[model samples]
Target: MEQTPLEIQLKTLPESPGVYQFFDREGKMLYVGKAKSLKKRVSSYFNKRLENGKTRVLVGKIDSIRHIVVRTESDALLLENNLIKEHQPRYNILLRDDKTYPWLCIKNERFPRIFPTRKRIEDGSEYFGPYTQMRTVRALLDLIRSVYPLRTCNYDLSEEKVAAGKYKKCLEYHLGNCLAPCEGLQDEASYHNQVDDIREIIKGNFGASLTYFRHRMKELAVEMAFEQAQAIKEKIEILENYQAKSTVVNPKIDQVDVFSIVSDPTHAYVNFMQVSHGLVVRSHTMEIKKKLEEADADLLPLAILELRERFNSDTRELYLPFPVSLPEDLKVVVPQKGDKRKLVEFSERNARFYRQDRFKQIRIIDPDRHVKRLMQQMKTDLRLSEEPRHIECFDNSNIQGSNPVAACVVFRDGKPAKKEYRHFNIKTVEGPDDFASMTEVVHRRYRRLLQEGESLPQLIVIDGGKGQLSAALKSLDELSLRGTIAIIGIAKRLEEIYFPGDPIPLYLDKKSETLRVIQQLRNEAHRFGITHHRNRRSKSAISSVLEGIDGIGEKTARDLLRKFKSVKRIRQASVDDLAEVVGPSRARKVYESLRE
Candidate 1:
């Protein structure tokens, strides 16, 4: 027995942390993964009996193996993340949410101003969150305004200008929203103290600001300033109300980042929440597309790094639903019970809802993309060489031996191309022969296309079982197109898909988009064929009834039909009315035939 290339590579793999890649025979990357021990991890794919069906398929496609040795597990993790993102290997999890969330920033200036922003600059500014919901940011800002009076002007408030009275009090001051720092009514020390308290509040530490307000209210009451005391009392109440509404966990479990993940077969949704003083100050959910089959352990760390950098978060501790490998400097905890556990669960709920909302939005807004994805899925599931962007389905319709017709319905990008639909009268087929009808229509369709140099569909679907499928193949063989285009037959009973030269049928999941599109194609073809068949049968009946009269010719029968519209109407018309259209001699014959 000869040793294979994979076995040879496995024997030489170093017992160290590294990243590995698998390639199929055609040099396409199949999967990319990281390993703490290259020898053990790389060997496990072949050494163990894989349980996952997709994993088994991936392994079966592996024609070559490659590995890159790294210094440590963290380095391996980073290398794996970068490779998966760059190559988008068929087996890695890729985050699809590319939109950056908004953050609340306190500008680095005298009398600092706070606002929501999407971009982060290197300038000296304090940013609080990359919150998913802009409404939450707006509500927080509104709450802050109710408690503290802050300037809203864009002014260079230098000491010399204020001392020189270069600027006067603005509307902000008149409206009691500012203390007029430009006019020197607001001292630098006093303004800095208020900005500091706001910074703490934004960080989810409300105790300091609340304590200061309570003490000031008491001082105002002692000095017998009743009005100012009541004002201060309202500020305290506002701050307390915000704190009560924001806090969701034990106050002791503060200054931590929380993450939870929910995944489907093709994508993963991750929710991140920043906890400060047990309050969820920032919350966001990101959707990640899976390339190969990356798990939560692979996706969560990358999301953590991205979110923390985006939000300017420096929290040292993280609360996660599961343990993950990360840098030694950051602590990861999986809470079992109490408030921390509830916080994790809350984050998971957010992820689940976000996934559902995203699905609905995609179906409504980007229907083309959704359809394209469905076509791609069908391409993969059916093992077609290309996406079925343009598909044609054939169905035969007949009643006993009276009228035989076949309809070819064209679908472009998973939508009905109504104008391109064609109907055939089944000229060569006799009786109610479905296989012969399918053969005639398939041959005539592509033969004309070949003659006119028109493009052929990527796929052809036949609405019947193996007998009809074999008949279709016979026509393809005559046109020398046996293998040029993909063709499949779908049985009406079980919806089994039959391929040329294959006996076993492919049964797609009932709820799969691929199956739905195929069913749509089948149903459309049947409807089109049935409609044409009914019209043809009606026309034949009218021709037989009208032409069989003694004095009527084809032209006279046509004229009568043209005037009366239908056979039933022509029969109902009186001889005088018919004479006005077809003359009295032919009219009497038609009238007597109707009477007979």
Candidate 2:
């Protein structure tokens, strides 16, 4: 039920624990929230004293409200997190904090094996934390090296080597950090004792360690060994100084690794925050390729595995945009509220800093100038609805009907999904017919959706005139997916955009965000389609006989075909650099083969 009187909506709210919703006059779902008491929380907006940016905006347009009472606050928390994710409410803290990072793992089993890992093992091992802070982890490692003297070695030791004295200790051994178990300087029993002490240190039992050290210092001083006392005092100072330097606060808490991924179509920025108990001791950000598909949950796992494989680190809690299965021995924590929430929020904010740090514009070399202008002009005109959300665009490219191809690209919140970039090889259409090509691509795209029974797109843009749009609509109707998606055609008119679905072309006013986004999409489709087109053409262009000739191979041959298109031009190469068209390897072989 929807109503306009904000007071009436407020009166309907209950003081019970539940979730709430706010809607605009058009009944567009704007925000979804949860509270310990639904009535109190929902009515608080109408209370007139909750002067915050989000609250004020919500209050102003709150035509109606809905309530769902949960049994408890934890239920409310879970429901709210889910609802907010589903609705993507405007007011809630929308964080894309997914992407696991590496953490140090010590298996909680009978033989606790400590090593670097991002995966959480479920074998009943105590998980320490996600150490997100790089500096903190480094300092802690340095301290562990000096005080705990844990083994950093990872080499296999043969019994013969131990007996023959053929193996020597590494630099970590010379520095008196690692136990040098391979050198046989420390037996398993003694090494185990040191490892147990190291575990205590990671557990932050510095008070006990400090007490033991102080007692030893006193005992040495009483024995009149001045040098020994001085050395002990120095070691104690190192331990104390390390504790003071690391962590953002005192009274260190258990270890946790926090991870946040800041990303769009073009890039991904990952921020790691390692906390020892409640103190933040390490933090760093690594920029990753924005070219990955964020929509595929499986892809995220692969990306994370790749990242951890590249730059492995020990961590505890792994705060992410998505929940990942972890090891039983590790303690992964993220606060939904209170102190840990603040840290997670802060980490998320840091992840977003890359928006300004770098803006890489990957442009298309193809003649996407007009299609680009159409996108530019569209954003120049946002007359009614929220510009366009979940836009699906399509483009068709072919080579004289032999290899017809079409690509459909998706854009969300004004960014492209290069990872979701798909290609269609015009199976149903014959020869250079863009309309039929469009029909084939559209049918296949929606047919899958039909088989799956999913929600349709909000808008569809085609890289052609009215005919292309009609083809798309026919496909939608055929698949019973019409009315679910709106269609618009962006046709090029002699280097100008003709949005027949709209009134004008190249409606370039100024600072057009829609235009920029549209241009980005069209260019992306063209680039992707043409790239796929070129690759197809090249693969069919020549034989390995040319490859065996040495003067030409893959990259160079493609370049030669693209540039000169004939062996005559390639054979008449002016310089080795010119022959270097494919690649250096091909160029070298080509030059040598030519000399022969």
Candidate 3:
């Protein structure tokens, strides 16, 4: 056998941690991945049978392999992320955010004006944040303005210009909003001191600002300037109120970065929060679109690095939902309990909310995409070989064995297909035996669909536990559809999902979309079944009541019901009213039976 180019490259691959790339015969990049060991990781592609369909396809197209050996796994992770962003391989999860986030820039100038800007210049100025929202920037700037009077005008405020009195004090000076640095009213040292305090405030450290304000207030009070003291007191109150709103956890927990991820089959949402002195100084959620099946363990590390880099986070301590491989310079804390755990949970909530908002937006703007993603998620969660585009759920309803009935609610593309909904009277099963009733309904439902050449559902949900699921499976076996269609039973007690022949049930997360959809299916089936059962019981009661009378037939009973609406109303009516409905002969018999 001739050695292929891929085999040749694989032989030369190093056993060092690095990033790897797969390329096709046409010299186009197909996929990029990071691995702890380049040789073992790259070789596994050929050694193992890839479970993901996309991964299998990606491997089949690969004609050559390339790798760059790095010093460590963290370096490889960083390198992999950079390559993916730069090249955007076909089989890499791309970070989808395109909007430029706003940042608070402290200009590198004499007065050092602070303002919010989307564009970042590489000048010697300091930038506090790439905050997720413009409102946050505005709010922070307002707080800064209220505490310290700083120059907002863009001018050359040099010592020589101020000595020469080149710039005039405008409305800002008269309004007391600015100390008029351009006209030398405020010295450089005094302005810089205020700037330092503002810097601490922006970093979520309000101690210095509060101390400065308190000291100023006391000094003015001693000078008998009550108005000035009152003004300073109000500014101190404003700063304190803002800090209280921003603060979340224990004040001792400072300079920490928290990250949490929530992912679906197609996309992952990673939320980042920067904490300083227990206050959330910055927060943002990054959305990454997956090109192949990726786990949270792989996705979170990449996201942490990307987010920390984007936000310029230098916090040594990190609160994460789970452990991931990262550089030793960063401290990864997977908080099991306490305030740190709460912070992680808070970050997770943000990610979940972002995912939900994106889902709602996608549902509104791109309904097909939303459906496709939902189907894919269901397929993965249920371990199905194919997406469950059309789903059917079965539920048996009976109250003390009176009227046994079943309902089959159809959901096409994860939405109720009302027209395809079905109702089944328990013909083969006697009493309220749910298992037998389920078996009868399942068999009858699919048999009719097969007989009529109608489309069968991709998945079937039984609103019961192991017993009902087993009964349904027997019907599927009889119809030779056991392996053809996917079926699962949901136990109401714990929401446990049971599969045929599997003793153990799969438990889904409470907030998962898969669980939600399955619960929806089960609820819909129960509602439909209960409705049909109620109607049947009502009709049966009406029939038994009127037919027991010797003179009353089905038509006569129906006529009485149609005329008076109910047996109670019919009893309330006089003989004359009864005769008007069922004629004189039958009316007297009905009146006598009722009176007895």
Candidate number with greatest TM-score: 3
| Candidate 3, run of 10 with poorest lDDT | 243-252
Give one digit per residue, the lDDT tens place, for model 3 in 351-406: 76557656766765578999999999899899999999999999999999988999
Off by over 4 Å in 3: 1-247, 327-339, 562-564, 572-584
Candidate 2 Cα outliers beyond 4 Å, as residue runs: 1-387, 494-511, 542-596
Write the number of the candidate with greater lDDT, choosing between 1 and 3. Answer: 3
* Global CA lDDT computed for model 1: 0.81
TM-score winner between 1 and 2, please give it: 1
Candidate number with greatest lDDT: 3
Clashing pairs in 3: none
Q: How high is the CA lDDT of each candidate model?
A: 0.81, 0.61, 0.83
Residue 203 alpha-carbon offset, candidate 1, angstroms = 42
lDDT of 1 by residue, 204-271 (tens): 77988988889999999999999999999988877777742232344456689999998755678888
